[model samples]
Target chain A: MNCQDLQRLVHAYLDYELDLMTSLDLEAHLNECSACRARHAEMRALRDLEARQLRFHAAPAPLKARIARNMRAACGNDDARRWRAWRAATAVSVLALAALLAWVVLPRTLPGPHQVVAQSQEKMVYHIANSEDVATALRNVANLLEISPDARIVVVANNQGVDFLLRGARDRDGTPYEPAVSRLKVRGVDFRVCNNTLARRRIDSSQVIPEAKLVPSGIAEISRLQTREGYAYMKL
Target chain B: MMPHVDAAYNLAWWLVRNRADAEDAVQEAFLRAYKFFGSFRGDDGRAWLLAIVRNACYALRGQAPGAGVNEEFDEQVHLPGMVAEGSNGPFCRNPEDIAIQHADRELVNRAIEELPVVFREVLVMREIEELSYKEIARIVDVPLGTVMSRLARGRRLLHEAIVARMKKESPK
Candidate 1:
């Protein structure tokens, strides 16, 4: 093999990805050519140096422990539900009796209006165009939802959302709520702001929540969240 | 949570480099994930959590851009002394063994952090996490070829950094 051919195959050969015939040809060439052999050795040495240096620096143990803790705290309540289910399995007879009594004693409960609307899956993120301050847009949505200090609503706004935020009215608290539109961040409800929208609005990263990341486009991110991630967007 | 903890921690570790930062990022990611769990559609919970980790790292850095860029190394130094005081001794196996193990880890992490933000992300996903190129492309919102090219370049750069470091350490 010529020098160029040998060089081309060198990386693949090192990785053992070269086909048998090509591998043999390269091997033969290396045997005959001192320069290629030396070159190959250098590459091999470089690869070895990298492997040795490729340290698994354990992430700070405290951090690992913390993540594990939070994830547990995050997922802990879930296991409770499972335990409840298992208990229900063992006490099926008691549950049946309690259900019968409850059914006879209480009036049938109907779903609330907001609950119906919330479950509709008809939420569409309106692409508000060319305004400024998406965080303010989110704060506006929170206000529109009449988001109180303790009450949080999922708000996903991106580029156009910025306009919506800029135009958003103050809550009863009289505080201008800057909506923190994160693409997949939900403080308790999912909210996404478009990276594209932020760009269109000429807002830099500082204006938005660090949690609010730049997705490709606000509208597309919204659509994907709704269809792929199952978030329902509502225009307030 | 138990099952996913290791994976989540690993991903966070890769992204933030520093343990404290990684922990902070992961914890915040979990909180955000939990609050947003209702929004999760399919089962790929790991990826969803990782997406949150990515955001958290951004958030941490956003809090202090200057600090994040420095990639604090002193945090690792306090570990050995802390381990001695603590009951677990150390989850890092043993101290002498870690010296060798940590050598490579430090290099990998330093090299990774040195990479451009875009390339560092792809390398973390592809190499550390072993994600598919397509999946990485989707997460980073780049094209497949861009992902591949970035991965190749990232590896090459990582190799270059490692070799340089080794040369500096070796006796002349």
Candidate 2:
């Protein structure tokens, strides 16, 4: 192979993509050509630099948990339903009696929702996309807090949802969202606004109410809450 | 399939160039994969997941308002001798200077980040992920020859960009 031909095949040769015969030919050319050898070395150096320096972003723990949760939710429900259907279709009289007995006994033995909540800290995330969403989120949070005063709640706002969090912003009836936000804040409810939307809409940080915290992205916050923090998600 | 999430996330992160969008792309890709999993007959699960992640990244880019345009590769613009023979050639410098340049993580990262998405993707697949050229071709949905050329061009561009940055950063 000639020098020009070697240049074309050099990366392939470096990558081991060249066949043995072709690689031997290229190696032979490299021995004779100092310029091609230097070029080859340069490519090798660049590859090493990349391997050593370029960051490989691993999936975050929260993301993995989120995917697992989603997969379980998607597949588990379908599989359970399918199994139940198959059992119902194939069951003889004795199996039907056994299944009926199990169904009757299972509910009494399993912990109820209230008991489950009492055993662990109740955590919830509310995704708010607009003004109305904020209203509904506030109501739900208030009710949940009344039920479980120590429940952890976070309300995430993006897009037009952030409008209510801004100072001087009001609801349709000219009622400022600040008082309700403050009430929730005192009750330990966290509020977050998406900084991306804030920047896109040209809203300054100072414009946001004191009760609201600025997050890098609202959707990311919601995902993190659900996956990493074990918070139940509610989109209003 | 679950073990490939990190690989999928890495590819999606490089393609989309942002954490938020990358996460969204990965989530969407996994969801799609789950939905159409019966169609997946391939033995290499990582390659399959990465292809879906790449598609998801592009789909997210399409939805983004005024996303940056990927530059076209022009062979004539990047003639071979231009960088190799220059004062800033990789081997032209002393060993210590070369070492220092490579150690600068931000410089290397910025150089790769500045390349157009097409070249960047191929470079990441080969250099970072260590995928074979044929595997990269399948994941990128391009001809094998196209993968080789893109990898070559991407490395050259990356090398030149790094050298230029080192030259600019060095004290006179």
Candidate 3:
């Protein structure tokens, strides 16, 4: 390689972008030519200087959090839409099952209408799947308690819904959910987190707040509540 | 995609020269990536994502009036006093002549920041991020030769800028 060729290929050589034969030729030229060697050294120095001095700006914590939240929101919406469509497709059968349960089970289990008005308690199970659902469930539970002070509310959280109950989980406003969860826990609401989700997501149960009880499976818990405990299910 | 966030942010930061703007660019780029993910054929996810990031940075620059007006690199204007390509004379003075070993972080950073965006992106990708030329070419949407040329020019421009700044700051 000549001086002109060395100058043209030195940067690529320094970058290790050249092929083996070309790289060997460049190195040979560098060994023979002092001027090209000096220039190559300068180029190498600049490259090394840049590697030493250029700051690599990592994504800030907030930015990562924001991107994660956005991704979850997008994916969550897609999942919710798919779930809604599936639910819509099965609405008829679900409605028929609801009617069958009400018809065959209510009269045998409940008191007379006059006594039912005064003595019956409202039992509801809420399914939460994301942060927004957590917020909605919180609002709905609060409203239910206001109307029926003796109401039983169980919030079963799985998927990203479990995040709000995790330690250090925060709302969009940066307020911790611990306070809200603790407040509702004292009000007789049961917050159950899905252990299955924790295992799948590789999260330790210790990471969950004390206010939530870890259930074996959120779906199974919801099923048990609906079938054996006679709780009305609501997905928020 | 999540793994490449840092790489994307680094490229975006150097391209836009601001933390907030870089964050914005990365966010937008990820959103674009997610939206068009169906189109992605599952090659190198980092390179694909970075290409989106580079485009997002340029789009951002285009939106803000006068933000990147001088983005088009003019060889004659930007390479003033730069050695002619393939000439026998030295491409730059010896490293010691410019006191490069003594060039502090701020000096090196400012000199790199002064480079045009086209060159700055390639330099940062190649030098700081240590990306391969083909990967950079894929990200920058340029040919391999263009990536090499830009990297060479970017390094020379950075060296010249640092030298000039050191001379200006010198006591004599």
Best by DockQ: 3
Give one digit per residue, the lDDT tens place, for model 1 in B66-157.
Answer: 13322233123332222443543222222221212233656656766787665577665654444556666666565665565555445545
- Compared with the true structure, all predictions reach lDDT values of 0.50, 0.72, 0.73
The two-chain DockQ for each candidate, comma-separated, is 0.07, 0.16, 0.20
CAPRI grade, predicted model 2: incorrect
- Taking every candidate in turn, the Cα RMSD to the unseen true structure, in Å, is 23.2, 21.0, 18.7
lDDT of 1 at A151: 28
Candidate rank order under DockQ: 3, 2, 1
Evaluated on chain B only, candidate 2 has a TM-score of 0.80
Ranking by TM-score: 3, 2, 1
Displacement of the residue A148 alpha carbon in candidate 3, Å? 50
Q: Which ten-residue region of model 1 chain B has the weakest summed lDDT?
A: B91-100
Could you give candidate 2's per-residue lDDT for residues A1-236 as a string of tens digits?
Answer: 87657767888987768988999998898898776777777777777788679987888889989997886687577554443333232222222332343344344553332233323356667788987677656766775564346778888999988999999988753668898899999999999999999999999999999999999999999878755665656666
Q: What order do you get sorting by lDDT, best first?
A: 3, 2, 1
- Model 2, residue A231: distance off in Å is 37
- Candidate 3 ranges beyond 4 A from true positions: A79-236, B63-78, B81-96
